[model samples]
Target chain A: MHIYVTDHNGKEHELEALEGWRVMEVIRDWGLPIKAECGGACACATCHVFVDPDWQDKLHAASDEEEDMLDMVPDVEDNSRLSCQILMSEELDGLKVSLAPSAKPDAEVA
Target chain B: MSEQEIVTDVVIIGAGPVGLFAVFELGLLDIKCHLIDILDKPGGQCAELYPEKPIYDIPAFPEISGQELTDNLLKQAEPFGPTYHYNRMVNELEKQDKGDYLVKTDAGETFRCKVVVIAAGGGSFQPKRPPVPNIEDYENTSVFYAVRKMDDFRDHDIVIVGGGDSALDWTLNLAPLAKSLTLVHRRDSFRAHTDSVNKMRALVEEGKINFELGQIASLEGENGQISAVNIKNADGEKSLPATRLMPFFGLTMKLGPVANWGLNLHENLIEVDTEKFATSEEGIFAIGDINYYPGKLKLILSGFHEAALMAQAAKKIIHPDEKVVFQYTTSSTKLQKKLGVK
Candidate 1:
């Protein structure tokens, strides 16, 4: 499926994601700045981002841990999801996600 | 209230890897520091959580656990004359008439120093709590953001919430220790690495771990302890019996009291000059994960580079003497000798 990823500076890139690939790997494999520090373990919230409002409903709902991590993200809104928590699917063919300017440092937010 | 004030050349506000690295850098410059932190021990989050976990990206070292790396960093900083105060949180920082800064801690101790470096990493980072009512009360009791002191939950049925690597890794670690383990993910697929996810899947296939693909709708507790977790899976909602809940869901980004420090905060990161790592305010600087610069790589090696450069700039600002030559440490001096650079 084609997914649109946006960087912190609003730069957009259209990339194809395998049917079940996590959004974080899609962005990281493309050499995006999303740290995914915990290596997409969902342990670190460094891969946090905001899903486009239009495709919010199309994506899977964030789990409790993802929700908790989003709370630590700066500029968090109703649409924030840790990119690692998002899995590519046919339903989210044209998903758009924006990287947050900063992931909450491990020390400050925990 | 009586406040004790002490003066030092530098005041580092963390005891983590980067903060300790600053002490080592300052030692090379022959500067003294007054280091403060809220934790009772050093290593910040590393000491608190995942001390035994292996880290592989520390430049020269192929792999080392968090504890070993912290020990090495501390040893490197010991000679630089850093006075460490534990269990003390910096409450505020005020500029003095003499151009220095007064750092006041929550414990009523005040430090007067010419420069301040914020090196707090994930320890100061707090986890986001579910928005369900009464969630805050369970913090540090039965609910926690991380698995601090794993033995605390030995033989207890623990429910870990998250689909990422942390959730999977911790589940694998705690699975053998806990009496029973439950992993709840928002989706059937996980985002963790292949090996860790495969291990978890194996455990699930063997019926050794209970895997729930869903969300935690609410948490019910009693006497300030979490008793059960309300989970809503794809099948339906169910109340899982939980003695201790470890939520690896992830961190939330909040600057806390530091937000009011008047530093230029962009998207929760402190804005600092790239070359000097200096914040908008004089005598104030940020490094490591808290500060971001253009073209900067956020690696431990990069943090060390920033610490050295920022320490040099700070030394020049604190003691601007044309005749004062920068002396290299034993390790750095050896490298310099080999490289033949003056």
Candidate 2:
């Protein structure tokens, strides 16, 4: 399957994502600056991305952990989702998302 | 003034199992190594995640705890005398015109190395700071997350906040060095080791340290230097005279600036060839869980294998004329000499 990612520098990359990989895997494989610090654990929000409005309904529903992690991320919107939770599949082909701001240290709580 | 820039033959990016082994491997070939890790100490995920958990997979040991394994690795690499830069993250890696790389840290430290090894297991672990306004401004000054040098806090009025091991550990360590020490927490309970807690209580009884039950309300200082902290307790907000503040809340994992170094990544991991464990970038290699290969197992023993191969390849980069030879540590006099066992 194919997925499009717009990196932090506004450079777009079209990647061939394997069937079982997550959206984060595709972007990270392209070396596009997505931290994915926790490695798809849904614990860190470094992989937060804004799903293209057109493909919003195509992704699997965000789990409670993903929702909470996304909530912790700065500049989150209705389209905000952790790319790690969005697994790649045949139905989710051609997914497009723009990288969110780097999970800043300020976003962390005491 | 900036710290003196370091120059070495190899700069291992993580001081985990693979990185430590890389030091030993490279040292056998007469190459010096320097290691940088975001964590305050070595062991990476093993020490951070399950230090006490027993694992039966390591080669000779029938069973060993995570911390025990890390201790053994560090001991094994001690002969190499690898320089370890802890509590710092490598933020930049740029190739020099001479072909060596200049590695810069977020702390403004730099290293020039002929080979870079990424043994970063599962990414770098970052500290989770308390939510305070403009906290970054005070970082590395009066406010420190990790103590690199004990003498830096000698004779200073220090206030440590947290109920965990880091807070309790530093409290025990810095109590005598600090002129006036205070340990603050929301309640009297602590998640630290009982021995540390009892020792802390003893210090408080001996009038060496002040134990306060409260939470930090605000910080007071000027020009990134802290003088006092307003803590909220049952009596409401009260100002405590303090010169240095240490908040040991805990750590959070973040890959941090590694992705920006232009290395080829495969799912948040560096891609390396199996033969040399070399990344797409020349003179750079990745091992441990941070590197992906055709049949990588992400095991500590597997990383040890990668380290041996990586060191051989790194020798070519560090000294092209050096002839690489395979020698068994049990019988080879040269290998035993490097290990300092002969």
Candidate 3:
């Protein structure tokens, strides 16, 4: 399975994802410029991403913990979700997400 | 200004789990210690990041929360009476001519120690800088991450951005002082305490402070002073006049100052041997998630084991002529006496 991830530079990369793996893990594994500082513990909001409008309804809703973590993010939107909370599944084979500027590594942030 | 100098047998740079555990192991060998941490409290990430999260891997306990584990570790190390210096970062480390090390902190304190143990897990926790363009330009002037003085905001147009406790608390504290105070957040709901949220709402209703639902879009400034801040919300882009701006996003770990300590680093982590867990410098050890080895696992238990081994080496360095004897806490009367169990 795979997912489409657009980085902060507006470049899209097709990443090979595994079933039951976190979308953030897949993106980080593919060498995408994501901070993902907490390593998917939902302790931080560094893995924030904007889900494509079409894929928004396909994924599960964000939990209260995830929402609380999102409160720390400076640039959040209506569709902003912590990618670490989203598990890649067969239904999300082509899950589309665009990395928020806040998700990039601190050094890479312009 | 004259700095306070402390003398100790060993100086551990980090009060995290591993550093706390090192106190027990070093104390057993008759070594005294002093710990330094950047956080106001100890436990490092376990205390700050996920204090309530249950960790499943800790031995003996099937599930233990981070804060609980930290409290237990502190209890375990209490008999040793290790001193902790919190809210300070070790800015410089140098080997003295007398072979001991001199450690200097940003808080204007110094330590002379026989050995240095770095249990710094993922480095120091620092306030996250918002990704606003050229935000660095206004730092310590028009833009501040932390409020050091309430008088700085007095009579100034202040714009605070965040929904957490720092933002709300500062909003309430600085509302009376500012010419105009605006609380901006990305969402209507706040993650701060209910009391603080209620108080902030009361201020908004009283027309003392304005609450806006939006994210900071940009900053308008000149010569390191911001004149206005642009925020984007559901309605449209809005600009608020501001002399001071504070954005409290949260804390993130960065390998600060430690990178300049002349220690060999592998991928931003200190390189250490698995045997002694010692760094490139003699009498200096690195453990926990901050140290890298061939089969290193960044687990609390792994850090515990490294602390035990590192303690033995540190003891040897501190007291070379003393004959080292291996004794288990369960069987040895000397060890039990040291643990205050006798």
- lDDT, candidates in the order shown: 0.75, 0.82, 0.90
- Tens digits of lDDT, candidate 2, B41-70: 898866765566677889999999878988
Q: Which stretches of candidate 3 lie over 4 Å from their true place?
A: A8-11, A107-110, B1-3
Q: Cα deviation of B235 in candidate 2 (Å)?
A: 11
Task: Encode model 1's per-residue lDDT on B103-191: one tens digit a residue.
Answer: 99989888888898887653254455554557667778887766779898889889988766778889999999888889987656676
What does candidate 2's lDDT look like per residue over A1-110, in tens digits?
A: 89988876687889899998988888877767776655665655677789999999988788755664553353456788888888899998899999876443223532
- Window of ten residues with lowest summed lDDT in model 2 chain B: B126-135
Give the per-residue Cα lDDT of candidate 2 at B267.
71
Question: Which CAPRI quality tier does the interface of model 2 achieve?
Answer: incorrect
What C-alpha lDDT does candidate 1 achieve relative to the native structure?
0.75
| Winner by TM-score | 3
| Ten-residue region with minimum lDDT total, candidate 3 chain B | B1-10
Q: DockQ ranking from best to worst?
A: 3, 1, 2
Better of 2 and 3 by TM-score: 3
Point out the higher-scoring one by TM-score: 1 or 2.
2
Instruction: Give the Cα error of residue B295 in candidate 2, in Å.
Output: 5.5
DockQ-based CAPRI category assigned to the predicted complex of candidate 3 = acceptable
The global Cα lDDT (0 to 1) of model 3 is: 0.90
Find the 10 residues in a row with the least total lDDT in model 1 chain B: B122-131
